[model samples]
Target: MSNNAIIFISVALILSALSFAMDRQKTIAGFKRGWQMFSRMLLPFLNILIIVSVVLYLISPDDIQHYLGAGSGLLGFAIAAVVGSITLIPAFISYPIAAGLLQQGASYAVVGTFMTTLMMVGVVTLPLEIKYLGRQAAVIRNVLNFFAAIAIGLLIGVIL
Candidate 1:
């Protein structure tokens, strides 16, 4: 593992130990709650994983390259942005998928835009966001994020 990952794990372990020492019962309760949440999410997580794996397997690298590579340009960016906004995969899985796409010859801009929109836009959760934050605020946030994701993708392409 990378040094940063090791450090993060170490810090998390230390914090967990400290929390346990400070309040054993509370810590146990927290663990139970966390486990329950994880259990609830497990099926959805696995389903997404399976779907992504199947899609990637079915679509050849050459096809991915043809559609999302450097040559695809603005059209590819738009398609990736829309796809990212609709998809709801967790970041832990999304990153690996993005990396895989990059390795398969997808453009940096396409992958970057996909990652940005996937995290920022959240079309799938718009209703929940609107309910909590109001329609105007949620719509504004998503609109701005979509533009920002495109800008970020372009910048990444320029830089890298």
Candidate 2:
């Protein structure tokens, strides 16, 4: 294991032991509430994770790597944004798949757009958003977010 991993584990163990000794039954009810809440969220989250992981494993890593390179420039960013807008998958589903793609060589900018639209643009949810806040509002928000994602990817390119 890496030195960082070892240090993190050692520190966590020491801290956990100290806390347990000092506060045995303290916050026990709070812990139960937190755990119940977490379990409720976690079960669905894990189900999605497993599904995404399986789908990601089926895809060729080369395809993901192809998009990640800087060869495409603004065109690549645009492509990324467009693809992102189309796929309305959950963030939990998309993130791990994007991460796996990155590991295979996808461009950070492209993956950034995928990640951005995973949360930002919502063509899938557009009807719902529009129902709640009119078509004009929905379109305006999505347009703003699409451009914002592109701007953000460019900014990161410059800074990083």
Candidate 3:
């Protein structure tokens, strides 16, 4: 594991030990609840992994480079923004996929745009957002976020 992973694991273990020391019953209850949540999520997590794996397998690295690499320019940014806005993968899951895209020759800008929009814009969840925030607010938020994501991507390209 990487140093960061090791550090996080160590910290978590230390915190858990401290919590258990302070309240054994609570710690046990917490563990049980955590395990239950994990079990509930496992199947869907695996399903998403399988689907993403198949999609990645079908799309060649050359195609990824052609569409999202440095030379793809504004077109790549638009594509990433649109797709990211429309898709609804959880943030934690999206990171590994982003790394895979980087490995496959996608530019930092494209990946950055994609990640930003994936998290901030909610085209796929628009109806739900509208229900919660009202149509005008939801639409405005998505529109602003789309532009912000593109700007962030451009900055990432320049900085990285």
Candidate 4:
């Protein structure tokens, strides 16, 4: 395993031990709650992994490069922005997918835009946002985020 992973695990173990020492019952309860949450998320996480793996396999590398590579330019950014805005996928799943896209020859700019929009712009959740935040705030937030994501993607493409 990587050194970072090892260090993280070791630190977690140390902290967990410390917690157990300080409050045994509370530590045990926290562990139980964490395990329950992990178990609940495991199935859906696996399902998403399977679906993403299959999709990645089906799409050709050349196609990815053509659509999302450096040469793709404005069209690529548009595609990435639109799709990213529309998808309601969780960030945890989206990160792996973004890595997969990069591995498949997508441009840094495209991936950056896609990731930014996925996290920032929320077309799918707009109605809910509107309900909670009001129509003006929700719409403005989404619009500003959409533009910011595109600009960031372009900047990443230029810098990288």
In terms of TM-score, the best-performing candidate is 4
Q: All candidates' TM-scores?
A: 0.84, 0.69, 0.95, 0.97
lDDT, ranked from best to worst: 4, 3, 1, 2
C-alpha lDDT score of every prediction, in listed order:
0.93, 0.77, 0.94, 0.96
Candidate 2 TM-score to native: 0.69
Better of 1 and 3 by lDDT: 3
Q: State the lDDT of candidate 4 residue by residue for 9-90, as single tens digits.
A: 9999999999999999999999999999999988988898899899889999999999999899899999999999999888
lDDT of 3 at 43: 88
Give the winner by lDDT: 1 or 2: 1
Off by over 4 Å in 1: 127-137
Q: How many Å off is the CA of 79 in candidate 1?
A: 1.2
- Lowest lDDT 10-mer window, candidate 2? 63-72
TM-score of 3: 0.95
Q: What would the per-residue lDDT of candidate 2 be over residues 119-159, giving only the tens digit for each residue? A: 89988889999999999999999999999988887776676
How well does candidate 1 match the true structure in TM-score terms? Answer: 0.84
Between 1 and 4, whose lDDT is larger? 4
Tell me, what's the RMSD of every candidate? 2.2, 3.8, 1.1, 0.8
Model 1, residue 119: distance off in Å is: 1.9
lDDT of 3 by residue, 71-100 (tens): 999999999999999999988778888988
Error of 4 at 68 (Å): 0.8
Candidate 4: where are CA atoms >4 Å away?
none
